[model samples]
Target: MTDEMLMMAVKNGDLEKASELFDRYHKPLYNFFVKITFDRDLGHDLTQNVFLRMIKYRASFRQDKQFRPWIYQMARNIYADHFRRNKMLFSDYAEVEDLKNKIAAVDEVMVEDERQKLLYISLFKLQPEQREILILTRFQQMKYEEVAQVLDCSVANVKVKVHRAIKQLREKFLELEKI
Candidate 1:
């Protein structure tokens, strides 16, 4: 069944369809979570939490709203919570060091292709929100509407963010001089 049908079933307390939807979306969502968090165990735990949240709130879900956004919102929450906990655990210097490693890993993954490396190198300098907009828009191929939904923002806001991110990315690329 389609997500809509399955969601309706879930809302109506149909255990079977809810189980199917849970199983279907679990892996891809987990992978997305893992890539963003860069922590496998956290991703696994967050994935479980996301599905559990869905199950817990199944009856209250709006039928017109898309499940994808709902799940992505849960992921965003999980990510934010993790970041918060990490911030409290580490001293400023340690957190900076950890971020440096994360940034290096991000660069390695995205810059492997020499041609694309310039693009990512430039983008890396932007604010986190701008960088996130670029990743969700340019790399993920998410439509502005869907992205806005995932981000819990307006479509116009998403567009502005993407446009600015692209402009800044270009500037960064030029500053780096392709080397």
Candidate 2:
């Protein structure tokens, strides 16, 4: 069944349909959280929380709306709220260290690649908003319209944000390469 159909069934109290939606989306959502937070454990927790909220707020699901963007919007809101409540700054020194360690663990050869390492460091150095925009548009391959829905902004604004983010990422990558 389509995600929207599953979600609609879920909204109407067919709780089992929610599991199918979760099964379909959990991996992508987990990856999304990991890319943004750079913490695997936290990503797992946040991903679970997203599904929980999906059920709790099932009635709010609009049948006409696309499910991916709606779920992504929920995840974003949950992540933002958790960040704010914990007073945790994204890309802080400790988190950056964690990200570096995780990257190193994933592949020693990746760490050996100077450009790859620099790109990762530069990506983490970006402001959360910029990093998020890039992750959604570039990494997740979300179209501008879907991203606009997730971000609650116009398509034109998403285009501007993505252009600016790419420019900033290029600048940061160059700066890091110099060091």
Candidate 3:
């Protein structure tokens, strides 16, 4: 169903309509959660939580708002809760971590070189804030304004971050070659 139709159904408090909406949104939100949290199990749980929040508050679903941003806002809140409960401890990131590490593992067989594996590893070392911009814009193909909404920043800020993140990624790979 179209978003407006979905909203109308939701407004009517129809459980089946809520089910359809959750099914429609599950995968993209799952991918978004994984890119941020770096844990498949946690990502799955968080995606479910997002849908639950939507259903729990279906009466408040806005007719004018795009469902995407509303769902993304749900995701952002889930992420914040995780970090808050963790006592803000991303305390030690000793090496290349989660998303980049997993992507590099897949490329290990395809690329056929230690050098490129090292380069992929270097990409993760960029600040998490920067990496997130690339994932949302480059990987997810989100528009600048949508990305800005997800990240809670301006469209110009999202564009600038994507540019700078790419530059930094390149610089990091080059520096790795020197090591």
Candidate 4:
């Protein structure tokens, strides 16, 4: 069944279908949280929360809408709530030593290459908004239209943000390479 069908089943009280959705989305959602927060344990928790929220707020699910963007919107809200509750500034959270420790704990496959490690380090260095846009558009491979829905912005705005983020990432990656 398609994700939308599974989600529709979930919304209609056939809760067992949620497991199929979970099976499909857990890894990508986990990786999304890990990439954003640099904390594997927290990623696991937040990803679980997304599914829980979906079940709790099932009534809000509109059958006319695509499931992927809707779930992503929920994930973004959950992440925002987490950020607000922690009251952490990006500078405070992105400490070099702390990031290195967290990144070291990330899955080996994601960090096996030296260049890939450097790229992630660069990603972590970006402003939170820039980092998120890149993760959503590039890493998650969400199309511009889906990203626009997830972000509640225009496709043109998403494109502009992506372009600027790539430029920033490139500069950060180059700076990291020099060190």
Candidate 5:
């Protein structure tokens, strides 16, 4: 079933639908959180929190709304709240111990290379907002419209931000490559 259909079933009191959604989304959600936090354990926790909130707030879900953006909105909020509470510096460019390790796992067949590692490092160097725009648009493959909904922003704004983010990432990647 489509995510929207599954979510609507969840909203209509078919609790198993929530589990189905969980099965489909949990890994992607964990990866999203891991990319942001650079901590797998925390990613797992935040991912769980996302689904719990979904169930707790199921009544607020409109059957007509797209489920992907709705779930992403919740994920974004959870990440923001955790960042705010922890006073974490999202722009830190230091080799994320966790990220460095995961790079090899990012693609089993594509042997980890310096350029790919540099790209991931450069991505982490970006401002949190820039990094997020890139992750959502590039890695997550979310459309500008869907990203706008998740971010509560306009599509034009998201497009502009995404463009700027790619530019920044390119610059960062080039600068890092020189080192």
Candidate 6:
């Protein structure tokens, strides 16, 4: 069944259908959380919390809306709430050993792994807003319109944010390469 169909079912009190939505979205949502938080355990918790909130707020979902953007909007709000609660700052860089393990395991792609490590390092160095825009648009492969919905901003604003974030990411990546 389509996600919207399933979600609507959930909204209508067919709570069993929520499992289907969870099965479909858990991994993507987990990866989204992990990428932004850099904490897999927190990702798992946050992902679970999303479904819980979905069920709790099911009545708020509108049939006119698309599920993807709706869910992402919830995710962004959850992440922001967590950020505010923690009152923490992003690290300048993740530890090299930790990043190495997170990036790859294949010996044959050692070179590629190095590149990915640098990319993630650069990503972590960005301001949180810049990092989030890049993660939503580039890593999560969300379109500008979808991101605009998730961020509650104009599509044009999303485009501008993405452009500036990419430019900053490229600069950080190049600077990392020199070290």
Highest-scoring model, TM-score: 4
Q: How many clashing pairs in candidate 6? A: 0
Q: After superposition, how far is residue 20 of candidate 4 from its true place, in Å?
A: 0.7
Model 3 segments beyond 4 Å from truth? Answer: 89-120, 177-179
- Model 4 segments more than 4 A misplaced: 89-110
Candidate 6, 50-118: lDDT as tens digits: 999999999999999999999988987888787767664443234678656544422233236666667
Candidate 6 residues lying further than 4 Å off, grouped into runs, are 89-112
Give each model's clash number: 0, 0, 0, 0, 0, 0
Q: Give the TM-score of candidate 2.
A: 0.86
By lDDT: ranked, best first: 4, 2, 5, 6, 3, 1
CA lDDT, every model vs. true structure: 0.72, 0.85, 0.72, 0.87, 0.82, 0.81
Model 4 residue-pair collision total: 0
Score every model by TM-score: 0.72, 0.86, 0.77, 0.91, 0.85, 0.85
Q: What is the alpha-carbon lDDT for the whole of candidate 4? A: 0.87
Per-residue lDDT, model 5, residue 87, is: 72
Candidate 3 clash pair list: none
lDDT (tens digit, per residue) of candidate 2 on 1-179? 89999999998889999889988999989988876776678889999999999999999999789999999999999898888788874434355667667666434533467666676667766777898999898888999999999999999999999999999999988887677
Q: In terms of lDDT, which candidate is stronger, 1 or 5?
A: 5
Candidate 5, poorest ten consecutive residues by summed lDDT: 102-111
Winner by lDDT:
4
Compute the lDDT of residue 59 as modeled in candidate 2. Answer: 96
Residue range 1-179, candidate 1, lDDT tens digits: 67877988988878678788888788767766545554467679988988887888888678788877777777677667766777742112246677677567656653567656566545545665676677677766778898899988899999998889888877888888845
In model 2, which runs have C-alpha deviations exceeding 4 angstroms?
A: 89-115
Per-residue lDDT of 136 in model 4 = 89
Once superposed on the true structure, which residue ranges of model 5 sit more than 4 Å away at CA? 89-111
Question: Which residue pairs does candidate 1 place in steric collision?
Answer: none
Candidate 5 lDDT over residue span 1-179, tens digit each: 89988888888989988989999999889878877655577888999999999999999999778999999999988888887686764434355775555554443422377666676677766787887888888988999999999989899999999999999989989898788
